[model samples]
Target: MKTSLPIFVRNSMYALRGGFLVRPLLISLALGLAGMILSSAEERFPVVSAWVPDALFPSHADPQVAQVMLSTIASSIMTVVSIVFAILLMTLTLASMQFSPRILVNFVRDHVTQWTLGVFLGTFLYCMAAMPAARSLPQPFAPVATVTGALALALASVMGLIYFIHHISRAVSVNHIVDRIARETERVIDELMPRKRGAVARGEDMEFEPEETEFAVLNVRSGYICFIDTTRLLKLAKAHKLRIRVLRPIGHFAPEGAPLFTVSHKSRLTAELDRDFRSAFGIGPMRTMQQDVEFGVLQIVDIALKAISPAVNDPSTAINCIDQLTSILIRWAERAPPATIFSDPPYVVRVILPWPDFKHLLDTAFEQIRHYSANDVAVSLRLLRAMDDLAATLNDDSMRKEVTLCGRRVVANCATRLDPTNLKRLEDRLASLEARSPSFATRGA
Candidate 1:
């Protein structure tokens, strides 16, 4: 039940990357502090002051010029920062209103956007910190090198602003958003399931016997189960000589006092063990990409759902979502899923956890959209084509069968709502899916 160090570090990193604040703030502060130190050194050390080229600052002796330049740059940069933030907020507002609100998370996590804020604020901080060094007090000192650095930063900020404008423009596009989600989900899949396609050893499923003396450990908090430290769970179970069954999977909601896990050999449980158990499961109000693949899938699904809704009625956007979902599913199908049963020693099972299988993930990725887009012929056709693409990629017969069944469902729903011509198109796509599977082809024949 005790969380391991690795899991704690991973969770901390996930939290750090969740928003746009921590990194940018740190960068700005670091740059600001550096500017103060560098300017101070340049003023105190005449040798360092000698490094400043005469061409850059013709009047290095007169501190007023440097003071005016640094102050103006700082003030102007702050103004630009305000404008940049305003534009960002407006863009996010428009994107949220037009697309899904969930997409705001994606925008917040964008590196370009984060760097944009950081560079702008960093430039402002740099100029401000260097301004005080350009004073005309006891001995007039300009800190020309420091002023030059501030000017360079200002130029970089200008370039960054241009890039930020370009990046934000594309980022607000639905296609870019969906593609970004797919890439992120695929990266998670690669990390979680490192084995290449068809590389996993296929063995007969092992049956687990129920433990005689089992006790349910109640959850202390009510929130979505964002991540479960499976390795830690396995190690804890091994150390205690117990078997553990995780009641709630990642992306599932666990109410307070609900059974979080069931541990065998209940007599061995102690207060420390219970605390460890609770700590191993990271429950939060919102889902993260830590171990929750469904969260990413749902992000895209949310967009598609909103696009095809009665109010939006944008079939093209829904189709784009389907295309991206297809890419995500294909990548997912190609990777071996993480093992559900974690064993400590060779074959000694210590932890039994439920991970979403390919079929369940397929359902999550397409089912809701399928239900919502049943009547939309364009969306329905794209859904079938997506399933067909997935079916073609999967090497397992059962997996192909699942895809075929999902395609059939789309066809069934479309037939119920579409005209003859649209239904024919749907049937043709369904046939393509069935043709990929020998079992489906035999049944059809």
Candidate 2:
């Protein structure tokens, strides 16, 4: 499915600020303020003095035991709230390790500022309430009692604060652990599940012959497919005046150990052919379907970059944003939902709704691009809103059906409204562009 970068960035910002940091701060502040107000009213009214002994404190009646009880409960609630915040922080840190670390760092910085202020306000309220009660206690031990009471409250506040900081720090550290694990896992997989010599069929037993006249194999890696230079193939094709053809083009599946080509080379050495094919295809150097999916996603990102460049110019920001977009798309494609049993075609496009929902995803995607550019909230939200539309549509069966119908109508309309000459002009420009920069120019070639 297409993505709206703006929606992604807007949601990310909200996720980072509103979830872990701002929300907790607001809750803490509200509770702290209420506590302070209640404490002040209690001090002024002197309602709870009946429970304490009047002889030890002549002017006032004994303070109610319930006030202390209530204060203790409030303190405990705040502590519990602090724990919830700590857990959220830890979860955020762990999830970020799988996707993006920068998101976690921003969460920490925002949360620290807001939570620290909240903790201070909360502590102040606790101290204010407890101090008055401590002062009313009997004579010789009065100063010692006040100090002890205040110290206890202070110690609790400090401990809560320390735990918050420690949780965030520890959560952030877990990212490194995840990274090391991923690297080691990839290394092991590369060694164990080595690329098969030839493509594999979907069926368990169906073997197929290679359809290409000339062939070469190469290993595929991110952003590139390393293959046999094709220098040997070209020489053979030209010298023999034979046509060159691609048997299993880049993305199609093939049976393992299937012949890539049948050489019609006159007077050719079988030993050389055997050696080259074994050395090249044996290592499974050819790009797989997964690689093609990644390459397609990367192309979309490049197109997105062009669409958003400042002046629609800042190529650097565009380049960086595109890289991030590519990474996101690759992850998305890998985890795309399984096709439903009733689905007519297993293609992702068929499953996705057209128009607005599509628009929204694009908008969310754009938000991310804009974030690195100028971080405009309005623009970002607009994109997010669009994404919300898409998500809503996808989740709604009626809306999805309407979108499908609308797409068919659009295609029908295009056939009538679109001028053949205009289409040719557009196609020519695209072809020219691809000739110049094959990697980023075309959607797929």
lDDT tens per residue, model 2, 330-354: 2332232221111212211111111
Which portions of model 1 show Cα errors greater than 4 Å?
Answer: 1-8, 201-204, 442-445
Write down the TM-score for model 1.
Answer: 0.94
lDDT of each: 0.84, 0.39
- Error (Å) of candidate 2 at residue 103 is 11
| Candidate 1 per-residue C-alpha lDDT over 172-243 given as tens digits, one digit per residue, 9 for 90 to 100 | 999999999989988888888888766765322656556667799998889999888777787788889888
For residue 357, what is the lDDT in candidate 1? 83
User: Distance from true position, residue 426, model 2, in Å?
Assistant: 19
The runs of at least 3 residues in candidate 2 whose Cα sits more than 4 Å from the true structure, single-residue gaps closed, are: 1-110, 136-317, 338-445
TM values, all candidates = 0.94, 0.27
Cα lDDT over the full model 1:
0.84
Least accurate 10 contiguous residues by lDDT in model 1: 201-210
